[model samples]
Structure formats: structure tokens, C-alpha cells
Target chain A: MEKKTRVLLFKPGLDGHWRGIMTVSKALSEAGMETIFFGFKTVEGVVEAAIQEDVDVIGFSVHSGAHLEWARELVRELEEKGARGDFLLLVGGVFPEQDHEELREIGIDGVFGPGTVTAEIVRFIEENLGRKVSG
Target chain B: MEEMEEIRRGLEEWREAKKGWPERREEFRTDAGIPVKDLYTPLDMEGIDYLGDIGFPGQPPYTRGVYPTMYRGRYWTIRMFSGHGTPEETNDRWRLLYEEGETGFSAAVDSLTFSGVDPDQEVHGAAHEVGKEGVPLYSIRGVEALVENLPIDRMSVALVVEPMTSAAVTSMYFNVAKERGLRKEQLAGTTQNDILTMTIGYIPWGSLKPADLLKLACDLIEYCTAMGEAPRWNPINFTTYNYREGGIDAVQEIGMGLANAVAHIEELLRRGWKIDDFVHRLAFHLSAHRDFFEEIAKYRAARKLWYRLMKERYKPENPDAYRFRFHVQTAGSSLTAQQPMVNIIRTAYQALEAVLGGTQSLHTNSYDEAICLPSEESVRLAVRTQELIQEETGVANVVDPLAGSYYVEALTRELEERIWDYFMRIEEMGGVVEALNTGWLFNEMSKAFNKRRRDQECGAERVIGVNCYVMEEEEPTPPFRTNPRAAEIEKERLRALRAERDNRRVAALLDRLRGVCERRENVLPVVSELTAAGATLGEITGVYREVWGIWQLPFVA
Candidate 1:
């Protein structure tokens, strides 16, 4: 039996913009990935859960313009736990395109901004994780 | 009967003649899925009576305009929703908008303030979002700084907070007005204390149960309007705009709004209040979306439906209770991030729809809002967009200029029936509160989100920059950055306030608040005193959560 790629998604901080993250979660699930939606969590809590669940991808969305701050906090939490390279880190939300490089520099593996299609995200996950997502 | 027969015969000939010409698409429908014909004639308006259905302005069934003179007497107030970084910075922005000819002010608070959490709270890194989404008004001092040196006595201000913190934040604003030598009765403002905003529009953290939220919402209306505490202030504005931005069409938008208003009305009535006590002070906030004619008809249908609801159900004696006055905001969901300059044109057309629909107030979205908060220059352009409509365009000169158009009148009649039908469906589900508890409203929102995503992906709904006329690679606009030291500054302000305020007095008042919550009484009188004594939002709402436990939403992915 093929092991299904597991992905975990959440909303970091207290921003209430959940449509973007929920849409991505449903899309990934439809594309045949084992997706877990941890609704609202702290960076430290999300890191601990991702490691315990053995998820291949850990994604979070930010629409409160605190993308840089949250991205840095998540990276720091993972590094402190010696799990920086254990999972593919992704961040998506309503942020400027110029911030993509800064987010990547902060150790984020995938950066999706506004106007992102769900298929593009599905393709990104499959290509990066080297697993074929069957729908 | 003879005249109607003649027009019907002529319309049949015209329909046959139009069959030879090729149409643009196989079918035409409004954004709400109402089928549209190639042409509308006098026959389409078959049973609609002018006097009974579309009466004169300011009369029953206000289909034309709410007021007799509409924009001819005075143009709609340009009330922009704005805030950022800190209360001081937000005040500066308010002054800029005032200088640029804005008539009203609206405060947009941050997430910490929205959820009744202070920056120093140990929950979920609340400090990171201190001043990120909007201005942080944690304590009474922040609200005072937000309206400092402004003519709040003359111009109306809108505090956009929801049920969880509406009592706390609104009391802070009222206390500030009183200290500034303005009587509470003389204050003119609005509190966006809608329950659905926090529940369905955008789910806040630590939200109360739906029934508890209703109690909090009706408490404000009971305090300000029914109790005559702030006679001129609009205690609650049913903000349908927030939910519409979540991808619902115009019909669902107004349907949900009407049902939500009914929930509050029933709650107040159950509390032993007459219908006329707070019904006249009820107001609405609507959205101006993509469909040009449909949006215009929506405003008209909404006015008529409100009049009908008041007449057939409540029958308030006050004439003003029947008037469905609303503020329209250009749809933020319609704007695209690619080729951001095109959002200017989109906003302009939507603004015209509001003007023609006879809105009482308007707010135009900035072109760069799809990416980040608007830059100073971009916000200035947004204010100018509304100015162009009022100054350059002659659309607002006449009241309800398109009142007699065949397409508009017919569409208005069609929409009224459809919206009422949808409203009844909600009423059948035991009204809005029961629907919230059953997770029915959330299901509607989730379905809309998925359907919209599918439509855009398959090219069924063509967004200019996202689907068609794509731009390969372009220079990104310079994003506006918020103050980095906002969190530190706000925390310091809170610390200073705690040291200066009388802690013993605040604690006693908090104890009184707990008793009020236990007995389920109005919290305004005690909350006003607490805010004046320098109690923060977190402290006031913390008591409510302790008394009535937090709600666990029946949310599914």
C-alpha cells in the first residue's frame, strides 16, 4: 500500500481570515492527500503537532499583514526543536509579492500569495514532496 | 387592459425579430442566478403598481429613495473605514481624510481588540497582531487618542466592533465623548454590533454562544436607543457587507441581513420592549458588487422589503422605522491583485451603482487593497474616486434617476419576491440564532466559497486580471508597512494606565459586572464606568467568558 502524503494546515495568530486557508485544505484533501486542519494554533503548538503526526507538509496562512513576523516565529520554533528540515514549510495569504523572497529567506519552502489557484498549490506539493497525488 | 394587450402583442413581435441575431452567450443571468432576458418591455412590469409597489420617495414601500430630495438636498456622506499601526496614527489618517473632504469617520480595530484580548495576554501570541489589522483600542486611553483634536461633536463616527466587544469598545467611545464636554444625548455615531459578523462573516477567537451574542447585541440597542442614553447614536448597524465579501450574491446578502435584523427585534421584544422603541434607530451597511443593474435593483428591493417587514409584521408607528437607509461600500472581493491599476476603474463603476441606487453613505476601496493595506497615496486616490462621482459626474443630481427604467423596475420586482422567499427559508430554520447553532449558516458560507473557486478556475467567472488578460510579470507595487514598534508602544500604554488608575475602584466595578452577567442584565451602565476608570477590553470581556463559557463552533472542513 502506498503511504499517503500527510499535510497539516492552520491559522497562526489571531487573524480571522479563514476562507483562504480552508479552501486550500479542501483542495489538498480532494487531490488525495491526508490533510489535517488545525484551526487556530500557536507556532510552538503547531510545530509539536506536525512532528507528532509525521506530516510531510506544514502550512499556515496569514492575512493580518504579520506574515514576516509569523514566518520568522515558525522557523525559530522548528529550529529550536531540531526539526527545521523535517517537514516542508508553506505560508499562504494576502501579502505583497515582494515579500515572497523575504519569506523564503526565513526558511519557508512554499510562498503562495493572492490570486493563487488551488491546482497550482496541489502541483507544488506533489512536485516538492516527490509523491503523485491521485484524485 | 386595452393598453396592456397592445404592448404584449408588440413584445411578442420584437422577441421573434430578435431570434435571428446571434447572442453573446447561450444564457444570460444575474450574479444571483436570476435569468435575464435580451430585452425588457412594458409587459415585463405586468402587475407592479406604481403607487402601491413603487411609491413616491419617503413614503411607504420606499422603492425610489428613502428621502424625498435624496442627493439633491445633500450628497451621501463619504465614511471611509480606516485604521492602522496605532490610535495616534489612525487619528492622523482621519485628519488627512477630513482635509480631503471626508464627512464621516469609521474606526477599524485590530484583531486583539476585536477578540477582546490585550497585547499583554499570554494567549496565542496576541502581541504579534497588536496593531497589524487595525488600530488597537484596548483601553479608554486609546479611544481618547483616536478621536483627539477631531470634530467628533459635529461629524458622525462609526466604531466597527462586534458583539464580543461591542459593549466594551462602545462604552469607551461614549465615555470619551462625555469627558470632552459633549453630552451623551448629543453624540452622533454608530456601533457595528452585528452578531453574524463575528459568527459567520469572520470567525473570531473566543466567541460567545449565538444566544449570548444576541443578548450582548440587543443590550446595546436597548441602552442607546430604547433607554435614551445616546438618543442620536445608532446603536447597532447590521453590517451585511462583511458577509457579502465572503462570495455570496446580492440576494443572499440582503436575505441574511433581513433575517439577522429580525433576530435582534425578537430578542428586544422578548425583553419587554415595544417595537417602536429601537426599530427607528436600526440601520444597515450593504455592498456594491459587480453586476451593475442587479446591484442597483438590490438596493431598491431592499428598501421595499424593509418597508414591507415593518408594515406587515412589526407596524411601528414611527415613519422613520420603515425607511431602509444604508451605507454602501465598493466590493473588496471584486478587486484583483494582478494589474492592480484596473481596480480603480472597477471601483468607479461600483460607486456609480451606489449613487444611482440612492445610498446614504459610501466608501470606495483603494486599488492596492488586494495585496496589503492601502498606502497613503492609494487611499488618497480612493477618496478621490468618490469625489469624482459627486463632482465630475452628474448622476447624483436627480433622485432615483433610473426609477422608471423598464429593466430596473422589472428586476426590482423580481428581486423582492426572490429575497423574501430566501428570508422565509431562514425563518423556517428557527431564525438566525438557531441556524448558527445548527451550523447551517456556516454551511452556506462554505458552499459559496467552494463554488466561487470552481467558477473562477474553470473560466466561468472571468476576472480581468486573474482569468483573462493575464499579465505575465510586472513590477510589484510598494507595500505600505505598519509601525514596527506598535506592539511595544501599546504594551507600554497599557502598563502606564494600570499604574495610574485606581485598581480598587476597577475591581469593585468588575465584581458588579460579574453579578450583572449572572443575572443577565444590561452591562452598559457598569461597563461605561469601568471603561472610564481605565479598565481594558480584555478585563471586561474576560468576565463574560468566565461566567458563560466559550463556544465551541461546529466547524467542519
Candidate 2:
């Protein structure tokens, strides 16, 4: 059997908008990734899930303007857990295009905003997984 | 079977008659999976009587219109939903709309208030949205300021709130009116006290369990029915607008709507309340989406079906209870952020369909909705869009203008059939409450939402400027930025109020609420008292949480 990549998808904020997360989760799973769904998780909960699942990527699907704060806390959480470099962190949802570079500067591997199709996210995770393992 | 075979044979011969015919798949269908015929004929709508089924305007079944003259008698209210920055800010916006010739008023609150949490207590909020996404209605004082100088007695108010927080908000509104010397009998307003939408559609911040919310909603209805003689307040607007945004098709939107209303009616009936006491005041919140004809048919079918449900099931004596009056909002989900200005044209078509479908009130989404709360310029354009429809276009001059068209009639009948089919299934599943509790409705919505998103992504479904007619690397307009100081000012105000208010009196009010809640008594009286006594939203909800416990249900899918 091939070593299929595993991804952890989490909802980090309050706006219980599940359409984006639900669609992305289904897409990742259908794209042959072992997806672990984490909802309403604190930054620590997300870090814990990522480490426990041994996921290659952790994606936070958030609404509102809280993505930056959540991503920062998540990066801090992973750094505190000593696994900051082990997993790639991607943040998606409702962020303005200008905030994308700032989010990546704060150690988010990639940023996907609203109207982003599922195929792009799936491909991004797969390619990032390849870079992580091959390196 | 023989006649069916003969027609099928003729169709096969007709197909063979064309030598260079295009290889077209005859499976063209609507978004709701209703098959679209090549051409509709009178045969498609057989066995349907026009007068008995639809009748004239302001007549039985109410399929034509709820009023005799329809828009000619009175134009549908242009109720633009505006709230942000603070209570005072929202109040100013409301006054502006009134000055702009808008008729109806809605007081909207931010997520923190809606979730039964104080703005100072937002857990996941980055502080950017505290009072800016909507008003920070954390205190009765704040709520009073929202409707302070406005005419509470005369205005047709629609509380832009869900059931989870409607109890607190509704009581607050009544208290404000009372303090302003307006009797409850003079109140003309609506509260969107829909529990199904609260639990399943808009996954709100954590609050009371679904069962407690249902009981609280019933309490409001009962209080309104028993207290004020000739009450004009609607205790609930069973909503499908919320559910539609969660990813169901047009059929399921109205299906869930009818089923959810049945759930509410059944619950109230079990309490031995007379149907006429509350059913007349029970309105609906529906959506006008991109499915133009389908949406029009959906509204027509809903009115016809609800008339039957109210007449046959409960048998209310008041004919007013049978007429369904609904408010429609152009679907925000249909708007695109890429070519945001195109949303104007999109909204124009949607608003037209809503008017054609006989909505009583309408809110056209601003072109900037997909990016942020509507900007003032876009909001004016939206209001003007409605005015244009009302004054310029004579679409609303006739009642049920599309009633006789073969496609519309067939689709309306088909939608009725599908809605009844849902009723049977929901009945067998015990009811809508059971369906919601078992996550059946949530699962159905999630599945639909996911599949629709995937289809749009893969070109199976088309959304302009999203997956089709697309622009590569298009520049997005600047997102609407919430004033950062709004949170700051609101949080400080909350702290000062807590420090200054009579904590003991607040405690007593909360205790009374808890007592009523525990005894399963009508909670609205105590809720009104609590709001009047300066009890903060968090404090009242704290008492409820202590009584009903907290529920943290995620979306089923």
C-alpha cells in the first residue's frame, strides 16, 4: 500500500459556517488523503490533534476576521509543543488578500480565502506533503 | 399502459425523424432536481382547478395574494437590515433608512449578543467584530438606545435575531415600548424565534439545548397570546432563509419551512393553546435565490400547502390564520465577491422574483455583502432597486401574475407534492424536532451544501465570476473593516455597567427567571422584568445555562 498523507482539518472560530470545512473535508478524503475532522477546537486542541494524528498538514477553516489571531496562537502552540517544523499549517476563510502575506509571514504555510475551490486546497496539501517527506 | 406505450413510440419516431439531431441528454433539471421539460404544455398540469386551488386575491388558500389589491393596495416594505459599530450607530442607520422612504425597521445584533454572550465575553472573536459586524445588544440600555428616538408604536419592526436570543431581545423590545408609554396592543413587530434555524442552520456560539429553546419560544408565543388584548406582535417567524444558506435546494428550503412550522404548531397544540391565538401572528422568513421560477413556485406552493395544513390539521376558526405572509431577502450566498458590482443586477432579478412571488417585505442584499457588511453607497443602491421595482416596473400590479403559465403551474404542483412527501417522512420520523435531534436535517443540508460546492468547482453547476465567466487574478475590493474602537468602547461600557448596576437586584431577577424556567412556566414575563432591571445578556443566559445546561452541538456533516 502507498503511504497516503493524512491531514487534520479544524474549525478555529465561532461562526459555525460548516459549508467550506465540510466540502473541503469531503474533497480531501475523496482525493485519497486520510482526513481527520476537528471542530470547535482551541489552538491547543488543534495542536494536540495534529501531533496525535501525525498529520502532514493542519488546516484551520475560520470565519470572521479572527483567522490571524487563531493562526498566530496555533503557531505559538505548535512551537511550545516543539513540533512547529514537523507539520505544515494552512489557514483558510474570509481573510482579505492583503492579510494572506502577513499570515504566511507568521509561519502559516499557505492561506486560502473564500471562493477558493476544493481542488486547489487538496493539491496544495498533497504537494506540501511531498516536499515535507522528500526533504 | 397501452396509451403510455403509444406516446413513448411516437416520441421515439419523432426522435428518429431528425437525422442530424444534436445528441442532447434529456436530463436537464433544476437546482432542486426537478426535471425541466423541453416545453411545458397544459397536459403537464392536469387535474388542477384554478379557482378552487388558487382563487382570487385575499381569498381562500391565498395562492393569489394575501391582500385584495396586493402591491397596488400597499407596497411591500423596504426593510433594509442595517446594524454595526454600536447601538447608536445602528439607530442612526435606521433613521437614515426611514428618511430614505423605507417603511419597515429591523434591529440587528452581533454574534455575541445573538449567542447569549456579552460582547465583553466573546471567546473566539478577534475583537474586530464585537459591535461592528452588528450592534452590541448586550444590555437593555443598549437595546433602548437602538430604538430610542424611533417610533416603536407605529413602525413595523422585525427583530433580526434567531430563537436562541429572541427571548431576551423580544422582552427587551417590549420593555422599551412600555417605558416609552406604548401599550403592548399597539406593538406591530416580528421576532425570528425559529429554533430549527438556531440549532442546525446558523451554528451559533454555544447556548441552551434545543429542547429548552423550543420551550422558551412557546413561552413567548403563550405570553403574547394571553397578555395583550388584540396583540399585533409575531412571536415567531418559522425561518427557511437560514436553512437555505446552509446548502439546501429550493424544494427542501420550503419543505423544511413547512415541516418546521408543523413542529412549532404541534408543540403549541400539545400545550392546549388555541391555534387562532397564535397562528395568525405566525409569519415566515423565506429566500429569493438564483432559481427564479423555482423560487416563485416554491412560495406559491408553500402558501397553498400551509393553507391546507392550518385548515385540515388544526381547524382554526380565524381565516386570517390560513394566510401566510412572508419576508424575503435576496440570497447573499448567490452574490459573488469577484465582480461585486454584478450583484446589483443579480439582486434586481431576485428582488423582482420576490415581488412576483408576493412577499410582504423584502431586503435586497448590498453588492458588497460577500466581502463585508454593506457599504452605504451599495445599501442605497439596494434600497433604490426595490423602489425601482415598486414604482417603475408594473410586475406587482397583478396578483399571482405567473399563476397560469404551464411551467409555473406544473412546478408549483410538483413542489406541493414534494413538500407533502417530506411531511409524511418527517411525521414518520416523529416530527421536525426529532429529525433535527437525530441530525437528519443537518446531514441533509451538509450533503447538499458539499455537493453543490463541488459541482460549482467542477463546472457541474455554474456561478458567475466564481467558476464561470471567471477573471484570473481579479482585484478584490477592500474588505469592510470593523472599527476597532467599537469593541473597545463596548467592552468598557459593559464593565462599568456591571460595576455600577444593582448586582443584588440583578441576582433576584435572574433567580426569578430560573424559577420560572424550572417550573416550565411562561418565561417572557420574568424575561421582560430581567431586561427592565438592567440584567446583562450574559447574566440572563447564565441563569438559563444553570437551569437547562449548555449544548455544544456541531454541524452534523
Pick by TM-score: which candidate is best? 1
Clashing pairs in 1: none
Tell me the TM-score of model 2: 0.94
For residues B104-133, write the lDDT of model 2, one tens digit per residue.
987666767777777666465535457645
Listing candidates in order, what is each one's chain A TM-score? Answer: 0.97, 0.91
Q: Return model 1's CA RMSD, one decimal.
A: 1.1
Alpha carbon lDDT at B211, candidate 1: 93
**Taking the true A–B contacts (Cα pairs closer than 8 Å), what share appears in each candidate?**
0.78, 0.37
Least accurate 10 contiguous residues by lDDT in model 2 chain B: B124-133
Best by lDDT: 1
DockQ of each: 0.83, 0.47
In the range B1-557, model 1's lDDT, one tens digit per residue, is 89989988888888888878998899999999999988888878789899999999888789999999998899999999999999999999999999999999889899999999999988888888888889999999999999999988899999999988999999999889889988889889899999988888888878889999999999999999999999899999998999898888889999999999999999999999999999999999999999999999999999999999999999999999999989999999999889999999999999999999989999999999999888889989999999999998888888898987999999999999999998999999999999999899888888898899999999999899899999785789888888889999999999999999999999999999999999999999999999999999999999999999888888854
